[model samples]
Target: MDSQHPPSPDSEQQTTSRKRRGIGRIGWAVLGTVFFGSLLLIGILPRLSQRSELQAAVKEASTIPSVDVITPRRAAATTNLELPGSVVPLNQTTIYARSTGYLRRWYADIGDRVRAGQLLAEIDSPDTDQQVLQAKAELAQAQANILQSRASLAKSVSDLKQARANLLIARQSWERWQVLVKQGAVPQQDADTKYATYQANLASVEAAQNTVNSDSANVKAAQASAYASQANFQRNTVLQSYKKVTAPFSGIITARNVNTGVLITAGSGNSNTSSSTSNTSLYTIAAYDTLDVNVNVPQSSSGILETGQTAQITVRELPQRVFRGKVVRTSNAIDPNTRTLLTQLEIQNSDGVLRPGMYASVKFAINRTNAPFVIPDSALVVNAGGTQVATITKDQTVHYQKVAVGRDYGTEVEITSGLTGNESLIATPTVDETEGLRVQPIAQTK
Candidate 1:
């Protein structure tokens, strides 16, 4: 019975007391509410203040000034126009073989100076030699025939004289017989016999005359044949002389195509001969002391060019030197396809410095006093209105000006109809700026 009432030991009595305690719970809830409310108020108030300051700063940045730029104008010296061309020999000749023969020996070669009629090479013409021998033999035979005909003609003439004497004697005998027949001292038969003898002698004289005529005709034929053979012999001799190739003019041999033992053919469409060595020319001579430069100038530049005008030439091989020359000739007509004028300049190359086939640059100093105002090409601005430039006014304002331009010199341009040359020009203008724009300029540094 004592334990069933409630065994309230010391630990059990303390637990019951704690379960009955609830007063501090309301105080803790009130403290948490006050802490959270203070945090909300502190965070929101500073953000609202910062937002207004940021707006004020943005407004201030909007009033900042723009950057300024400046440039200067300069006067440039007049320049000449430079063009490109090639060098060529003023007088060039190609040497060709006139007769074909085996090359025996070459006396001249490339770079060898030769005089007119100088021996260039020698040809072994065995065929031509044989022709000469044959012609000589024919001529001798013809002369022998002529001698035989003359002998025959002399014999015929002697026979004709004997026949004439016999005819005269027979005629005298016939007349004596006729007188004797009239005087009865001769028989008729005798007279008839004498008359027959005279007739026979006359016939013999006619036969001798015909023989002489035949001999004379034969002599004439032999003489003609001899003349023909002589002509052939002379032609062969002349052709044999051609075997030694001679220089046509005084010049330097620029080429040689023949060597020893090479076969050369006659020039009349016969290819039976072959050269002993490949790439051998008979001779090629040229006078390199004088040279010509051919230049193709644009049609627009053709009008100002004239014969006898001085030209300055620069060869690529001789870079450090310039050659002085004069215009020798011009085509006088423009080429339709290239739209250019073909001009030639003659240069004296006596020092052998300027060679043919060298590339060259020619400078033409054209007087362009009639040309318009010129400016730096950098000042031009290309847009929808053709070409324009930015000009600075006296009041420090910029103007976008339209201009008509001409020949361009890479870094400069010619103003054909647009500028007065007195105004200041800007080399480059900003895209955001336009006509009548106000600016504060700072001088440009070089």
Candidate 2:
């Protein structure tokens, strides 16, 4: 109790603090006001101000000058269209073996020129030769049989003659005997015997006639056999010639499939044992002096292509060389699958410079027309609608006129329609320029 009065000052202060709460109401209110004010200014106000400034910039840039300037002028041009096509030979053929035989030798080979009826190769037909010999033997046997039959016929004829003589002598003897009997110089029995002898002689003469007829028939049969044998022998000899092979036509030997000692099977049903063996060709020949190119044209362009049309062919192998040709023929019907017309072009290659199966490009000029307005391709502006050329009117204003374009030259285009020749055409136009825009004209320097 003694210090209580003095401690009163500091103690009284501590007691007073305890009596109050954790924070004052005024301090809480002030903190809440400051947080809400900062959120509004930092987040919402800046977005509003930025949006206004962006809108202002957009409006300002929209009014800026857009395009550069270009002048219009006129130029002369020719219109021609280019078509894609390949070069081809006019004629081609593949050769195959016709007969089966051992390839004896090849006289002609690839790249060798051959004439019509020239021997291409020979076959060793030992089998065919043996068959011929066998046929000849059979023929000789037939001839010998014929000779034997002829000799038998001759003997029969002699016998027939002798029998007729015997009959004549017997008849004379019988008549003499009969006369003697009647004159009482011969006996009756003897005259009867002479009559019997005369009958016997007549029978012998008839028998001899029969033998002669048979012998004549045998002789004819033998002659026929001999003729048949001769014919067979001749056929055999012809078959033996199959060993030699000849070219079917005059052509160069473009292919050789067989070499010496290669066995070639006879083609078709020809028997190797027959007198005539089928001659199998060992080399294939083709006439390459002329070349043909087959082109498939779309149906749309088919109408313009016809026989005798002029064409130019360029070979890929020989790029610098261009061969002149004409449309030799065409398949009048269009192919359904490809919807293309088949056309053929012929070119002469007498020098043999153009080989078969070489790739080539063919160009055909289908239509040619005079263009009223022709200008350089650089002047054209292509958009979604169609092609157009920027033209300058007399009032010095630029306008885009839609135009129908025809053939295209390397640097120029043909205006088929929608343009008058008198209008000034722009050689170059700026993309930023719009229709109806005023432009300053300057003559283009060629």
Candidate 3:
């Protein structure tokens, strides 16, 4: 119908209107395409930039292993260390007879509590008593002999005086005979006889003097013999006193192997003769007023303990008890075979609750003069060489440090000789970690 109407003026005007409408439609299509294209570009440009950056970062990260790191915590001034231990009596001894004889009577038996001087048993030491009596009699006899020798000395002195008097009288008689012979009033024979009598009296005086000297020496010998006899008597008396067996210290008797009428030998070279546990002892006494908790502490932790440091003891038998103890002794040396120290803790046991050879746990609160850094237990690397840890420096270089470890608490460990607490430590070092490997350390948040 439009093609037939083209001869009219409306038809020309409609054709021109159609051309304008088509041009308007073409212009709107071009504007819509330009706007949509600009929106698409605006949305995709940032995404593309971000994807490029992400890919670049992945490539960089793949060259280095990412690791979580932790800063070591400063160790406390005092650290608690627990070690397995055994409880023992403070003083233990095996009793043996001091005198050789049969056991006469036992005043204290096994499980008996006795004082230091309490009688434990009696020995029928008849020979010791007989020896004491004999010594005493010999001493008395020696004293009597000394007295007799003194009397003989006195008699010899009297004889010497009598002989001296007789010599003086004979001298005077001889002098008178000589005068008579010179005066021709006496015979020569009488003068000669008086001279001979004087000479004989002089010889008797010399004999009496020698007898006095001999008697004096005899008295001295008797006195010395008496003194020796007295010493023997005293020594035998001391030996006799040993017949009464007594306790050497205050304690409870743990064992008694001898009874009345048992033949107990004295000073027999057996286990009882020494300080060790005696299998052939008459009795065994253990002092339980204090107990010793012996623990083998690691050499690293041993140096921190001292003699007066207080410790805690937990007994397995008494699970609820926490016994207060003091560090009494230590070997002060590291055992080469075990690499440990023998430490002993002393605990008061006045209540008699603790016994010897009981299982125990000893806790020593040792104060370190130089406290070590504490790190997570997972950071340690143990190998055939020794224990080590991985640390990262400020330059992001991995450093494998040889560390001395102490007091492992499962979650944490003490670095006794390595890091300065400020080092960034790797949680777990890999086998490929070296001293100068560059690493990407990620700080552990927790």
Candidate 4:
């Protein structure tokens, strides 16, 4: 809009300087834009590439399942087999009266230790005492009868001697008469009377001899009666001795069924001939210097049990104490009903800590020639096919192995077959797991 004018040198120089300054500013702005764009491309491209690589790795890992694996370990050669047992005394019995009577006094009681033949109680048997007195009186009467019979025998002998003298005198008289009659110096009637007198004397002598033999027989009968009376008296005295109850063996009394004045009957209360009766036994004695532990061993382990095998016994009441014992006997024959062997163990109980009728556990250390492999219970895969275990191969492939189970140890199970104890086993296989399944095996710590 202004009028055209001729340019001056100063104006042209100023214009040129302004144009050069604008061109320099444009070039610097273009260089700044190029440098900032290069920096952004360098930072964003690396982030995108790393994100894509991470996504690919995650996708690949999701296809395979991670499995926890464990190496199989061999079980111990000698394992402790624990079983239930019942404790009892080595010798136990119930004492009863041998004679029927009333209890008079007691010397021993429950928990009293006594020696053999020690008196436990006394019985008052008036009947036995009276019988003994009667037997003695009868024995005395028999002895007196024997003495009287002997006196009678002596009198009979004296009579026999007198009769023999008379017989001799009569024989002489008869001979004199016979000689007189033959010589005609005496009458025949006088000879006949002399012969009759001789006959009478001979009859008296014969009667005296018979009386002497009867006296001798009476004396023998009296002596035999006296011997029988003596035997009866001795038997009564022996019965009286039985009135005193005594211990048959050295033991501790466990029960007292009778007190003073209680009527007791003869015979044993524990005899198989009768059922159990109350107040029948005077006392129950048990020998506890040694204790017996009875246990029924299972059939699987019974074959290895024998006498003299060491055992360890523990009771719940005595938790801290471990009683050591040995097998004393075995039934040898198995019980078909229970499929167990009755085994008895004897333990020294000098301290008297172990008692009868206690529940206890017995442990036996059984050594095996071939120990089976053991695995966690979770490793076993039980199904319709059979018992199996999930194992991993070198290429991380799952293989189900059939295994024969031996003993069940609660948390673990014994593999009697199908394992060499060198395979890697899956600790906890899932239901989805199958044979020849590819998995990522991860070793477990335990």
Judged by lDDT, which candidate is best? 4
TM-scores for every predicted model: 0.55, 0.49, 0.75, 0.63
lDDT of 1 by residue, 361-405 (tens): 999777765566777677788988779888778877788778887
lDDT of 2 at 52: 88
Off by over 4 Å in 1: 1-79, 132-238, 266-281, 316-321, 333-339, 383-407, 416-426, 429-446
Better of 1 and 2 by lDDT: 1
Ten-residue segment with the worst summed lDDT in candidate 4?
A: 269-278
Deviation in Å, model 4, residue 110 alpha carbon? 1.6
Computed on alpha carbons, the lDDT of every model, listed in order, comes to: 0.78, 0.72, 0.86, 0.90
Please write out the lDDT profile of model 4 over residues 65-148, one tens digit for every residue.
989999878889899889999999999998888776777888998899999999999989888999999999999999999999
- The TM-score of predicted model 2 comes to 0.49
- By lDDT: ranked, best first: 4, 3, 1, 2
Q: What is the C-alpha RMSD of each candidate to the true structure, in Å?
A: 23.7, 25.9, 6.7, 12.2
Candidate 1: residue 257 Cα off by (Å): 2.8
Which sections of candidate 4 miss by over 4 Å?
Answer: 1-66, 133-235, 268-278, 316-320, 334-338, 392-399, 436-440
Give the best candidate by TM-score: 3
TM-score result, candidate 4: 0.63
Q: Whole-model lDDT, candidate 3?
A: 0.86
